[model samples]
Target: MLGPLAAGAVFFPGLFLVSKGALRVLLGWSEGDAVLVSTRLVSSLQAVMASSAGWIISSSCRDVMEDRHWLTEAYVLFATPYFAYDVFAMFLCHWHKQQVKGHEEAGPNGGAVRAALSGFLRREVLMVLHHVFMVAFCFPASLLWRRGKGDYFQGVLFLAELSTPSVCLGKVLIQYQKQNSVLHKVNGVFMLLSFFSCRVLLFPYLYYAYSRYASIPLLRVPLVAPWQCNLGAALLWPLQLYWFTLICRGALRQSGRRQKPPGS
Candidate 1:
């Protein structure tokens, strides 16, 4: 498993590199901007693959996903490295953008490209925190998974990322200024549906599953146990809810404008 994870870590940057080149040549996107979109597209595709497999294997368990410690361990073992890769990749992109920003200011197009990349990075503050938490906690837990207490609980948390593909696609479409395209419209609709299903509507059920299957009831579970793993899990709900609202508003506002047509 670690072998596959190591391979994945090695290949993640390669995926970013290939995708960035394709976007730049195919779409004439600036290098920094192309990499920004390519990175999300690649990450989103990986999320779908991993989460889809998780959901399927989880479905076969005698009970809910939270009851499958092995499955949880399997996913975390595979996913944590990619999460680490993401943190490093984002940091590298940031540093590269900063180093070139002053030189690139000579051209207006270059400045806009840099600004677009900066805007995307700024919007990822919460996502950066989310990644940091996973790397700091989930990665280590999965490594020592055999001795861990909350294995099943963590499996369920990873499933919450199922909507990420749509979210990524929606952002990429926006970056390309494809607001009025039919594909963009369709992707927006899916983004709203997936966001609600995975991030918003499914959360209460996740909590219920935790309460039902946990060794101790969720409320009774001590936050300090497992060295505050429970605390990290408990706090993610507010972040999900906040991001879900943002998704909904953006989707709805765009859909409305899409219907209005130009010069109405």
Candidate 2:
């Protein structure tokens, strides 16, 4: 609930600002750009708001099912598909990024050949490990949530969530620490926070929902303490907003750096 609210406050406003800013930057238009563009932005915001509301309503309904004895059925019908889609999208995006990089490096025919050869290997080998790790972390938490035995399993889930951010942060810290660009450091910090928010907030809620409501042996206990869940969700939006800002800033800085006259 609070998660959705936080997302609304942080992301919705930030999205509006970014889109408006981008339009201004691209078109060199002032506040009096196009009436239609403004209208469309508002419309898009409304759509996002509607979607968030829908999630809240659906989550509430799932909670109700947990209060009853139907959590497992409800979860399977609703949550499982969403999780599947998320995982699939993650892997697909990863694969796409690799392919794009390969194409850029190899150029035209060589790039195409490399991408064709590497794509399946990347998906089946590299991305499969990520999927396996996510499941390994999540499944035990589901068991704990189902059995109402909230102890070490919860800790384990938390650790698993932390693992990804820690790895990512470690890489940046080790490899890019000496890069004195303020933008790079800022981007790294936000990236770390984004990962932290996902681990500390998003993944936990997901696990809670899955364990208590979504799967075959629904635990039906509150996955996390209510206050914690709400707070975590509330924090997610700001983190995402910052993350987006950092990415855009980094891109701008990188572009500027690239365009600078050498030895000038």
Candidate 2: clashing pairs of residues: 3-233, 75-214, 146-219
Model 1: which ten-residue window has the lowest total lDDT?
221-230
Over 4 Å off, model 1: 22-29, 63-71, 91-123, 142-153, 214-229, 256-264
Runs of candidate 2 exceeding 4 Å displacement: 1-83, 98-120, 123-127, 140-146, 151-183, 190-264
lDDT against the true structure, per candidate, is 0.68, 0.43
Q: Give the per-residue lDDT digits (tens) of candidate 2, residues 120-204.
A: 5554553444345334534433443345333222332333233233334333343434345665556456655645554445545
Q: What is the model-wide C-alpha lDDT for candidate 1?
A: 0.68
Model 1, residue 250: C-alpha shift (Å): 1.3
lDDT of 1 by residue, 83-173 (tens): 7778766755564465466564423466665775676568677878888887886576655643645444455555767888877777667
TM-scores for every predicted model: 0.73, 0.30
| Reference-based lDDT, residue 197, model 1 | 76
Candidate 1 collision pairs? none
Deviation from native of the Cα of residue 91 in model 1, angstroms: 5.1
